[model samples]
Target: MDKPDQIPPLSIDEISILFFNRQNPVYIDVYDQQTYRYFIYPIINRTVFFGCLIITLLRPLSHLERITIEQGSSTLALELAKQHTLTEVYYQKTHEYFTELLEYRESELILTKGKELGLNMNSIMFVTLFKISSYQDLQVLEAIIHRLVSIIKQQMARTEKIVYGFHNKVTLLISLSSSDSDHISSITKLLDSIIKEWNRKDGPPLNAGIGNSYYGVENIRKSYDEAGKALSYLTEQNRPGMIRYGEIGLNRFFLNQKSEEIERFLNEIFSPLWSHKAKKNELEKTLLVYTDSNRSAIQAAEKLHIHINTLYQRLKKIEEALNLSFNNTEDMLKIELACHLKRTFNA
Candidate 1:
């Protein structure tokens, strides 16, 4: 209040204080004798006598209040630190279980350990893999990951969960009651909110893939693998956001295959279509739309913005060139899978 208008703009700390002050209302202790005396007596007597008296009276109380706040803060900090330490240790152990990366014969031992660590072994447990990208600075990436982890912990504060990070990815193991109906929907909503919260802070691009919940220790690795596969589907197609493993369908199997293998599989099924120079791309589009539209010629034509007769002619050409009958269930199945594989590889 005594300073001139030549002050610099607010520093980070000053802005933070301003933010906190705006968020929290200011409180006035009107009943305090010191406040009453200081404001009223200073105006009336215009002397330092009451001011000195108030200070002398308030000194001990101020000291005691300061000590109380300090000790309370210190104790709270220690308790939180201890709790966080224990949580991290449990998370590390869970991470180790995943790190084993294989189902072993000593699954009972691992299950016992998990139960002891507060994991609900008999309940529905699954994993979600999170990946952060588009950050070139290591320090910024680390900070973003840390912020994301904090957000996860906050969001799942009421749940039994294990959160551990390695490199640029985080693995979250969440346990739900077996009777919790609509688990996938609930999980999706939770993850969507978490991602939105992170986005609100202008955090890095985040993507997650959720695995199906399974019982028993042997399926833990499978769930983790499924989560990774789901995430791979997102990355391979250059898409973002969350995908559940069950939703990926057959791509789950193909995702584990090598690129060359996928290419060969695609080529075997699509060679004839690719060999057609003029309409290869068009034919592929037709096949994909045909199957995706549930083999409804009218729907496919409407989507393709062409007449039904034209769609029929294109289908005929496709069948003739591929030396297969769309009427045959096996042939149609192959065509459908080929389309899926083509998309999975973005070919």
Candidate 2:
């Protein structure tokens, strides 16, 4: 296969000399971060018409480019980008360089392509449903999450909020953006498309958040949260690999926190109870609600719509069965985390 370095990277020094050597240029060549990073050779030509041949052959962009031309001067640079499906391009010298090109969006597209190429997610918007059955493997899993997070670096981007709520499995996601009317319908369609594509595939245990049309890298965590809930709903429902955020709806954020691995955590927590699937599931539900209701048994009962006494009885039974007391702040914190485990790791 051809290599990037083999293709040649345009040198800034060489390009500067070439541009300055030209006569009164109608369109002087300018290589922004994207052009410089992608092309070993700078994009330069005698007129707007010259360098487009190269750009059309290589589509390396995450956004559409815009080019403004003076009337009767030349054909537009943006026209070339659009015809070739280039991420973006600009003609006017006054136009700012493609700063957003190197934006997190580029990283995300690269990550997505990596997944398509069968590489593990460096985490980010794609929530990993890893099953580290033993305690030792959990270390590797933790390392994976940490590394994945650092690779994506969502914090530095201009995006919507990323909120995490874990029952045990970490539920990171980006918030939805309904600000643009054109985007709302597109987002829904995109989510639907993901559901279709997921149902089509049949391989490695898949769990993932279907991203939204929000033009923010930060809201990736919200998308991750929705996927996690859909995974949680999987435990209740028989189907697997079917994740649609609309199914989880408003309470989605509660299931979005970051936490420990869920499947193993649940298995360890309910070892005794797992023998009886119904009772184990009952405990899981109660804990889920208990935490979801913010540690208030009364509130949990109200949400579950069971009598407060019934909730108290279940809590008491859960405490006795698990050998942990929610009354103890530390124990309660652990339980809250465990409760999240039932949701995140696709248990």
Candidate 3:
């Protein structure tokens, strides 16, 4: 019941809301799908009430039955409201705690807040960012965030995870009991599954970028930064999938370079074929495969599923356009670098 995904199937139509004393304490009447009776409960507020209530009811209620229950529940309502106040306060505090942590406040202050929230800060942890498109409607986006947080919490029920949403992004702070590779692999696979499921839905595409794990609370900000960097790398590559900060390799250095600089380099190297929109992917793929194959025409041809003569012909066209020779060491290295940069930044 504590898991986020365990929300009861309470439909909007099945809910009857009553605001007692002008919204000071709200009473919710729910018809539980699993039980064949009705239950009326008082909640502190609407925003934090989901998954916080337990109801037992199945059938629709008669007008008289509803009134009788509402009138009789007044005494119980006050007691429940008092109990739920603490929960509302806890959520507000937790939200503030995460906001401060992500904002890179003073380390000592962060540690104090972590202790207050009962969060373990000494464990091995990393941050993973789920970058969603901003095209979704505001209400729909909020629902998506809530659903995603629930799914992630449910998936990592055995592990320690903190899921938070801000704007169009969802930040996942996962704490590991140990730095074992097996634990990392299992969690990574779970995140990959989540991304795949998200894309399978009918809305915007989803991508994940994971940062490396580190110990201590001070490195939480570092992990978050790495996650953002990895996400930028993934987006610029024009791909849909998860990318880990450690996996991006030399592209990490490229990311550190200003975007304008990267663009300048791409334009300089690819000036010859800038006008060839039709053969861009095909030609880029050809050059990359050729360079990656140790400049072996046979191997490159085999990989590209083309005849060696065809490979030679494409190389000739590339050389003519760039006015560079493959035999020149400097020119060949420049070509290799250009191909990689073009693929990485998609400039």
**Could you say which candidate leads in lDDT?**
3
In candidate 2, position 35 carries an lDDT of: 36
lDDT of 2 by residue, 1-347 (tens): 13323333434333444444343323222344333233222232233221321122244433333222121123433444354222112111101211222233556665554345333333223332211122234323343233223322343243332222121232333333345646545544543454354335422233443433234444444544445566655544344454555656533654544334445566777665444535556666777888888888788898888998988888888888889887799988777666665555455
Candidate order by lDDT, decreasing, is: 3, 1, 2
lDDT (0-100) at residue 203 of candidate 1? 54
Local accuracy by lDDT, each model: 0.66, 0.44, 0.69
lDDT of 1 by residue, 1-347 (tens): 12222223334333333333142212222333223211111101111011101121222246675466446545654564465456556556766776653454565776676666567777777889999857665543543455477778888787777677655888888777764667657766989888766555545678888888887555777888889888988887776688889989877777767778778878877777765456457777888899889999989999999999999998998899889898899988888888877766775
In model 3, the worst 10-residue window by lDDT is: 13-22
Root-mean-square deviation (CA) per prediction:
12.5, 20.4, 8.1
By TM-score, who's the top model here? 3
Model 3: which residue pairs collide? 37-57
Which candidate, 2 or 3, would have the higher lDDT against the true structure?
3
Model 1 C-alpha lDDT versus the unseen true structure:
0.66
TM-score of every candidate:
0.64, 0.31, 0.65
Q: In candidate 1, which residue pairs get closer than 3 Å at backbone N, Cα or C atoms, i.e. clash?
A: none
